[model samples]
Target chain A: EERPPPRGLTAPTVAAGAIAKKWLAEHFGVKIRGYMSQLGPIVIPFQSWDEVENNPFYAPNADVVPELEAYMDALRKDGDSIGARIEVIAENVPAGLGEPIYARIDAEIAYAMMGLNAVKGVEIGAGFESVSQRGSEHGDALTPDGFESNHAGGILGGISTGQNIEVSLAIKPTSSIRIKRPSINQAGEPVEVQTLGRHDPCVGIRATPIAESLLAIVIMDQLLRQRAQCGSDWLETKEQE
Target chain B: EERPPPRGLTAPTVAAGAIAKKWLAEHFGVKIRGYMSQLGPIVIPFQSWDEVENNPFYAPNADVVPELEAYMDALRKDGDSIGARIEVIAENVPAGLGEPIYARIDAEIAYAMMGLNAVKGVEIGAGFESVSQRGSEHGDALTPDGFESNHAGGILGGISTGQNIEVSLAIKPTSSIRIKRPSINQAGEPVEVQTLGRHDPCVGIRATPIAESLLAIVIMDQLLRQRAQCGSDWLETKEQE
Candidate 1:
């Protein structure tokens, strides 16, 4: 959604990603879900977000809420912070989306994820774990039916493999902590710094929705790039293939 | 270097990067150099390509030619291939070039280098080596004179620090080797393939100039981006600061 600037004003502000996601979901049957994969040392086993609205934790597992709360309580008591991991999956993504080399879907995903506040690392599917795997153990087997696995994370050689696109992010602890620590000044002098402001002990609590939105934006961008490079019938041709 | 497509053609063909580099050099005095850092196991000690055209090796060291020839001869004899490493540096790059998050200068460099043929990995400054380094060891110290070091590779927080921007690439062996290899055809049938066309045993030999062009293109791109986002006088303001 966009609105013209008021009289004498120069520009209009818009939530472009949110608007685009809404438009895409309305036009295409794309479905995306982002959820906390881990909080501090706790691994959350939420497979879906069906009950996210019903719980303050925004996860399916209500049982894990106590553990998460306790963890947050301990962090607050110690005037400390913790990190988190989040996962996002996009389903019904067009198979022919993404470009080679510079604009690979996975590369774009990493760029987008790392751009997010506090994100330090990003991975696609097996990611770093695949480094230890033999080819036999890592390469997904393609069958006449469909892909037998998604170890390539829905991408191969910088192109989409027509599977569900998956991504994970490692977010660093919130930097504006209550704990006093060593720091620096603009003059390159050593200083002690302690952030004193209303801050979330764990910013990851709000990242799930934001991550979903970001993934949507990246997919939309890739879709636009593919359309520009291959024309509108590209999807139709890919479907026939 | 752009030519209007003859007569009935609607578009023009152009060597855009070459033209851009020439224009930037003429207008802004940006200087760039790219050279082979290593070929296979041979580490090239060439600091510059001053005598690149005087020798068939395109390197400053004439003595290394025999070793390079020997390595290529051995590869040709075995019908095998080997990888290469290249380094590109841009000097007089204005400080404050690049964008945050998705379009970090280093990220853009990685994206551009990865887009190049056969490039498997990219590193900025100390790059992967920093993985093993502590913060004190990896971070470049800022001083009144300038950065005490450049371990950040001329960039900090996604912006240029006006230092010489350095980038390195790990290029895989050229895939079109003479050796017969097992592969699959479009019909999903097993096949043995051997390339027949005249091919360079080491593609990196020709990559130096191209990589220079690529880095120039990336810098020019970031310059344009900075201008668009921060206004045309952004560089002047940054220099004032």
Candidate 2:
């Protein structure tokens, strides 16, 4: 479909990964979902998965419905470029799945997400915020009813805490905007150029599926690693190769 | 070395890897350094390699002389639990050293760091701070001065941009604190027990060298990956493998 994406203006070629993720999720029994938490400077309050499913903008909630329409109107009015911050959730990841220190869960997740074309940042739960916290404040206290807090973002000592894995990624503004900008060509002479190609206004708008796919890939890799490190119990159904 | 570590007590097993790292760095141009950035609530600002060399508290810097002495005195006085934040720097990393998505550099680094015991969080350069910055502010502008800024922490789209790679790791307090704490034995008996074993007070005290070693392993893995992906021009003197 050549039409503007129902979620955002990203090229369909990129967003197309969602279809594959949908199929993989069914086979894996892992639910992966992503939604825009922020668009440009327009921030949206977080919504549960139930609420996120209905958003036409593919945002996590309807909290920004009016703001979204107004922003879209303003974009059309002033022809400005925008960016998005996407949050992805991966549920049902088994604990004891990641390798320690060298092949870790958080490290793997960060690597996968940052590898995306426009992702400028990746945070697991309260990632960077923890830098400002004290050791006592940041450490998750354990209780009989599970962890009192998930400040560790479902990961502890680099292994899955059996809590849902949450990752937020920052997708930078598309550099392919039509605005004319100065650049040096191959011979190094400065020239003003306007980009022309398949582009997305905010590529993150359509990135949910892609995020899911990447998470799936990481999860799958970890699953195999878990089998190798922890034993092959999870791979009981696998045909001997 | 048989004595309990002055900070978070730890087994000496981890610190042994640094000896090998020192030898490895001599052969390769890449040099890895790690030291305590935070001890409990005390924060030591980043220091240059020259300043960091003479620290007695395992910091790379001699800058925290007064603070280090006072902190050590207090640790000896109260004998309370504490943790450390370690920052590891990898210098002279070649660009394009990581896979675009699946086998990314940041992911590899994070995995290596997080896999270590007691590491609570990991950051790359201005890691989590970018969460609040604007797109215009966060995006590193291209210049003849290379990347102009390394807010991306030497990685872009999962590949090294030929910058010094910086990693910050938050190491949790050692679990074997001398404090009398409550825990359930395997028989489900609630018991107040004191851990008796060889332990460091703050495991991070000895971790600088260990962190250095882990970083070495990751760099070597990525270096081999780089050679495999980009071929042997980078490894001009490799023995047949």
* Candidate 1 regions with alpha-carbon error over 4 angstroms: A1-95, A99-158, A161-241, B1-15, B23-29, B41-65, B101-103, B225-241
Candidate with maximal TM-score:
2
lDDT of each: 0.65, 0.64
lDDT of 1 at B101: 55
TM-score of the first chain of model 2: 0.81
Best of the candidates, DockQ: 2
Predicted structure 1: lDDT: 0.65
Cα deviation at A151, candidate 1, in Å, is 12
* lDDT for each residue of candidate 1 in B75-97, tens digit (9 for 90 to 100): 78766666677778887788877
lDDT of 2 by residue, A148-208 (tens): 6766777765578777788877666554445554544676566555554445555666667
Q: TM-scores for all candidates?
A: 0.59, 0.72
Chain A TM-score, prediction 1: 0.85
* Poorest stretch of ten by lDDT in candidate 1 chain B: B5-14
